[model samples]
Target: MARAFQLAGLLRLRQIEKDHAASDLAAANAFRRDAGERQARAIAALHAVPVEATDASTLFAMAAARASSRSMLADLAALADQADAEVAEAQTAFGEAKARAVGLEKLEARHNASVLAGELSAEQAAIDEIATGAWVREREGNEA
Candidate 1:
């Protein structure tokens, strides 16, 4: 019988960690995209604001609107930066998990190969012993 991999549990845990890291990376990328979109919208809104100042009140309102849009854009930029950092961290984690899993898999493959070679060697030895027994019986009959 083939022996079970000694690090099977560790391999499973590493696989789970890799999956979680992948999920986190995807989420982080989505958040970054969303923040970028919001920033673009804020910029567009700021640009669309009418510059025509028919009176003092309209001019003051335009100034306030521009100020709010700029503030929102700055906040979104910060969010985007944070999201980018998260993605980088997740990618690093995924890479490490993948490397660990690959290492364990290689070890398991090597162990399995060794087991198979041992079984084959045993079978060959048994066949050789049977052939020798048959040869000895034939020689004894001839001598008689």
Candidate 2:
């Protein structure tokens, strides 16, 4: 009988961990994209604000709007940076998980190969014994 892989359970756990890490990385990437889009919209709105003001009050309001846009853009930029960091962390975790799984996978492959070889050898030995017996029986008949 072929021996089962000893680390199959551990390998399955490692694969699960890798999958979770990949999911986290995807979410981080999505957050970064969202932050970038928000920053772009804020910049566009800032530019759309009318520069020409007929009265001092209008000019002050425009200035205030521009300031608010800049502040929002800055916050978004910071969020994007945080997202980038998270993505990097997630990528590292995924790589580590994959590496851990790979070792077990290779071991399982080797174990399977060894079992197959043993089975093939046993079959060949049986065939050789049957051929030897037939040859001996024929020789006895010829001598008789």
Candidate 3:
């Protein structure tokens, strides 16, 4: 029973670790897509103007590029923070899983030892019964 509980706990902890890893991967992928989009937008703004045109359109485009770059930087910072948090959480969950697995292994070893001890005791009892029966049969033959 104790072994069963430990195994159950280990499985539960491993599941949690898997979930945390999935979430971490998703967040990283989202961040990558966000960076790609920001780069594409910036490139588009840069390509909007000819080299000789010094007009408001060109200035606005440059400003827009700067703003987009800054926004992307801010977004990346936020994503980094979120990713860090996820990594910490996943690490914690993995540690928990490792601990649970170790505990389950110990519990199983203990249960096996107990089973072996009981078997030995039962074998001893059987041997004593057989010896007594054999002795009784020999004495009956002698009396005859």
Which candidate should be chosen as best, given TM-score against the real structure? 2
Off by over 4 Å in 1: 126-144
Question: Least lDDT summed over 10 consecutive residues: which range in candidate 1?
Answer: 42-51
Please give, for residues 1-144, the per-residue lDDT of candidate 2 as tens digits.
788888899989988988888898888889888888888887887778678999999988988987887788888889889988988998898899889988888998998999999999999999999999999999999999
**Span of 10 residues, lowest total lDDT, candidate 2:** 42-51
TM-score of model number 2:
0.91
Question: lDDT tens string, model 1, 13-108?
Answer: 888988888888888889888888888887887778678999999989988987887788888889989988988988898898889888988988
In order, the Cα lDDT scores of the candidates are: 0.86, 0.88, 0.68
Off by over 4 Å in 2: none
Q: Which candidate is the best by lDDT?
A: 2
lDDT of 1 at 84: 87
How do the predictions measure up, each by TM-score?
0.80, 0.91, 0.50
Question: Candidate 1, residue 53: CA error in Å?
Answer: 2.3
RMSD of 1: 2.6
